[model samples]
Target: MDELSALAARVWGELAQAVSTRGHPWRTATLATVSPEGLPDARTVVLREWDEREQTLVFFTDARSPKVQHLQHLQHQAQAVLVLWHPGLGWQLRMTVRTEVTFEGLAVTSRWARLKMSPAAQDYLSPLAPGESLQGLSPAGASRPHFAVVHARVLALDWLSLNPEGHRRARLCPPERAAWLQP
Candidate 1:
């Protein structure tokens, strides 16, 4: 492989390791999207899956969530960003991605089946959609069709490593572009 390919592979490898490592804060990334009003919305979401070959990342959410609507509005302009910071490791990854929402079909069905069997499935069982105010906590409900899986196709990966001596930063854009940048 060429130099840029190797660098991209290494960056992806690090991200894959971070997501797979239990208790690592990197497992949770801040997902940022643009609201219909042109406002920015961000929330912490769990990293569900990472495919290095496809250069994609996955996250789960309720289809009725506001973010889902934001994604729909994006459509062809479905650009989003995911930021991951690991204080212990002193590494930060800011990823530019094209987002795709999957509510039905094979991918969603398989994920829903697996999630339904896991304790985390409770998140998708909410009677009221996300951001709704409640008088009290509602009992866990059964899994519903609102469960969705979001796939993000990586467009660019900007990695920053903090160090006492000197910090390092690198940018990797798909198909064969990568370079170190001034930190």
Candidate 2:
């Protein structure tokens, strides 16, 4: 394999690790998207799944959340950026991805099955929509209807390493293109 392929493989490997490794710095990424009003919005989100073959990343969110509404407003074809940093490796990865949202399909059902039994399920159980004012300890709803899954197809990846000796940067457009960039 050539140098660029090797580097892309290494970066993909770390992204896969971030999915299953709790507390991994890359396990939580900042998701940046454009709101319905055309303003940029960003928030930290847990990394749920990664598929190297498909070049896709996954995360769960409330169906009524602002992020979901934002994606819907854009017709789910808009591009979003995910930024992750690995403190231990001194590396940062900025990925440009196409977003898709699933609510009631098998994709949502299967993930909800696994999550509904865990404490994390409470995140989607709130009676009020995200950003709505709470009314003093309101009881959570009993179902998982609010759960939604976001599947992001990575279109491009920009990787940067902050090494003590020398910094390096690279960009990968996957399946075919990769190039080193000046840092």
Candidate 3:
């Protein structure tokens, strides 16, 4: 395998280890994407889950959010980068992954529901459209409700990370294409 690919595998393994030991990445990562006009937009969000087995990463956002729209349109040609900073290790894990949007599976949805969270998390999922600006006191304040239309489905993913170390940079290469480097 090429040096670049080998380094990537090493860095990816490090990140997978960190994710397993820590429930989430250090903080939310900045997810970057390009618009059809070639403009790039990025936002910081929590990494809800990561599936190293499937080479899959997961996050949640409002279905009507612009980022979700951009991801849906760019799924074919786009790549995503997840930067996980670790001060203890003095190393960061830069993961580059191919982007794919999907709804949470029964397992994932159940996990979300089961997490111990503030009341707002549940109310935020009310039937209201996700991305719209609220006019005033949203019904969100009046009632707590569980929704199926929650289109909680904006569950999209971006793929990719880079390792600056000589043997750590990785791309969104195929899963079986992984090779180990001497980092």
Candidate 4:
């Protein structure tokens, strides 16, 4: 393989390894999006799927959440960042991505079906939308169609490895382009 392809492979291999390893904090990433007013908003989300070939990452979220609104408004820009930090490995990955929100479709239906069999289904069953004040606890109900899937097409990936011996950083761009950066 070419140098850039090798770099991308190595970086993606590390990420996949991190996800596969148990108790790895990198399994969750902080997704940062911009609001309609050009304000930045961030929240923690579980890493659901990673497509190496397409350079895309997936995460599930509530459709009614503020982040969804932010994503909708920023869809034209399609610019967002996902940050993953592994303290044990001392590695940080910053991915700049183009965001796409899918609320209704075969993909959403299929994922929702699989989620229904697990406890995660409860997350979509809430009667009240996210960030709403409630007078009392609400009982869980059937899964709502509001469960959404977010696909982030990675535009650039910056990997920072903070080793005790020495720190290393690299930037990877699409179509086999990579460069080492001073950390």
Candidate topping TM-score: 2
Ranking by lDDT: 2, 1, 4, 3
Q: What is the TM-score of each candidate against the true structure?
A: 0.90, 0.94, 0.58, 0.89
In Å, residue 33's CA in model 3 sits off its true spot by: 1.1
Error of 3 at 173 (Å): 6.3
lDDT by residue (tens digit), candidate 4, 1-183: 876568678768766765566566777899998889988899998877778888888889988899888888855787889999978778788999988989998979988888877888777778777897876856755445569999988998888889989998888765556788899
Q: How many backbone overlaps does candidate 3 show?
A: 12
Each model's number of backbone clashes?
A: 0, 0, 12, 0
Query: How would the candidate models be sorted by TM-score, starting from the highest?
Result: 2, 1, 4, 3
* Model 2 TM-score, 2 decimals: 0.94
| Prediction 3 TM-score vs. true | 0.58
- List the global CA lDDT of all models: 0.85, 0.89, 0.51, 0.82
**Superposition error at 136 for model 4 (Å):** 4.4
Candidate 4 structure, TM-score to reference: 0.89
Q: How high a TM-score does candidate 1 get? A: 0.90
Candidate 4: global Cα-lDDT?
0.82
Model 1 regions lying over 4 Å from their true place:
1-7, 136-143
Off by over 4 Å in 3: 1-27, 104-108, 116-135, 141-183
